[model samples]
Target: MLAWPAWLTILLLVTNLLSLAALFFVTRRMLKLRRQKKRAFAFSDYPVRKAKLEEIAPCFAMSGYGPSPDSEVRFIGGEGVVSSLSDRESWVMAALAKGVKRVFEFGTCSGKTTHVLALNAAPDSEIFTLTLHPDDLAATEFGFGDDREHRDIALSESSFETFYYNGRSSERHIRQIFSDSKSYNEAPLRGSVDLVFVDGAHTRSYVENDTRKALNMLADEGVILWHDYKPGVPGVFAFLNELSRTLPLVHIADTDLVMYRRVRKQLSPA
Candidate 1:
């Protein structure tokens, strides 16, 4: 049997260890809750009003017979495609592209959306798609406040040198601009684009920059769509929430896309 002192020592040590383990678990759980709270505070979706597809555009309204021809789009599955749009989102965009004369897209990741835009647009329509070349990631100008996670994702997604539309006939309609969107000039295309898709780097600075340029280039009746508006993507979620204050941004119901139609020409922020 152990001596009284030894028994006391063992009891104290065991008690200390159990207390430490409990404290460790409590600390871990507290940290997790704190992180969740911070995320909720930073990335919540209460700012933008959500709307059904028909509310955003008349083309999404159902015809008495069936889906309108404008809603019929040539679609490729997301299988083996990285960062592809959801089927519903693609349909919304393609339907919007129908009959549009000029479309501008920021961030041509895989060019899947660009191809869809071309397929649904008028045969003579031009699709201008911009993306950073994999070789030129060094040129990315990420701001200090940019979300680090998405900056990495932006670089990773830029790995495509050849896109989905590379050899297809849609290639004829797409003008691929290989440059960081921050450095690309929108002057030549100003007030001419009927549709604009802003899917570039999810960094706040990049979104702001591309949006300013999109506004400058938007035709009077043009539409702009921004992807990844959910809370999981902090950069897009927060930026668009703030943008909703000044612009009439609509979150498409059940999708991560936000839509805006210009009521009047707005000057780009200098």
Candidate 2:
């Protein structure tokens, strides 16, 4: 091989170093996808909700959300939190078991909680889960093998980026639609969305914004679930303020979660 001049050789070395840096960046992302967290379901040892299928059908019928069947979901938050999953996870399932017409969730962390909900949904009902993982790796990383078939979690990872400014996310690369505003061209879904659960962000502004976005999507008769309503989270309490006092809402049955129904009459009853 011919030897290069001193200055030219230095330039070549710099180029090589830059290329290495780029390669490392790509590799780090791949590793993140495979990385598994040590966090356990706060209620790992607690009993799973066991509402009989018969009990869940009626909630959906009354809600008029759509064709929601019986369903439940499991979530992992701070330690000992899910021990019984408190109301954040349970109350919704109880409602789902009551036969809510549809199920919608944000933040598909580890696929456990959403999976719980999907398993119980009525055969005709559907469960939709929004996750941070992209559409491509969703099947490979989040898919828990044969167990996934029944859950029917229509995955939507797009919203995580747009609504959250997930600029570097794979959603941009793959061109997927994550939010209804995107799908409907900056318009909300036609008609109304049945139920919405937003748990993706924990910060006050983030959670508050998500709540507003969900509100616009739900059917007038729909309900929305907000996670991380415990003490210390600024946004939880602030977001709650946006709701009218007369709206029908319940604090987490036994936990710090919160829920609201979309009844306009309840928005402000004198």
Candidate 3:
């Protein structure tokens, strides 16, 4: 038996209503990531290179799957559990399978993923990937003509060509995409990317910078996948979870891959 004012009673009701709404939202999202049933890339024998196939066989002997770009990796069968694909390969395949015609990526460590994009594009699709490695930078080359003084020039040119190995395969059809000599934040590909995947600079500051830039450039149908989101990683989870007011997102998590796709578009005046 306590005395309460009429206005105070209304205020309490409003507060409780707000609390319920917040709880509903959080629970809904948690279920979306955890209880999802539609997953891609469970098993496939198709491959880009002979070397890649050989590597996969030995690695996934127990698990039957490899680290993939999105979702938990899949194994062939029989508790195969499979192994993870080399992170670089997983990134490329995920982009292709997502029906992305144009892919924008950050970090070109050894230019592996860039090369992979060059491997999986439709006949005429354009792949615009970027990396910080300078085209004229000095690098080591083996099996070149034995001219020590001229070796540097040959190596630099060869490196450029090798970065696009995906287009050279005889069995598959790939598009020609060269590595752009631009910074990730200042690249010219604004508002024109179909898919954006960020695996470069795992540090918090660098990761945030890449993400901000990627968001601006991501296209209407584009999906953004963040590489290396293990159960224990720090900065990545923060970026995905912050700013719920904007950045409507759905996260898909597995052992090695974590993806956030824009399921619904933000309605703004065109």
Best of the candidates, lDDT: 1
Structural similarity to truth (TM-score) of each candidate: 0.79, 0.46, 0.47
Candidate 2 C-alpha lDDT tens digits along 126-208: 55555544444333222222123212232332223333223422122122334322122313343355767777545444454
Off by over 4 Å in 1: 1-45, 63-70, 78-80, 264-270
- Candidate ranking under TM-score, highest first, comes to 1, 3, 2
Model 2 ranges with Cα > 4 A deviation: 1-88, 134-191, 242-246, 264-270
For residue 96, what is the lDDT in candidate 1? 89
Which lDDT value does model 3 have at 206?
Answer: 50
TM for candidate 3 is 0.47
Task: Report clashes for each candidate as comma-separated counts.
Answer: 0, 25, 12
lDDT of each: 0.90, 0.48, 0.48
Name the lDDT value of residue 209 in candidate 3: 69
Whole-model lDDT for model 3 versus the true structure? 0.48
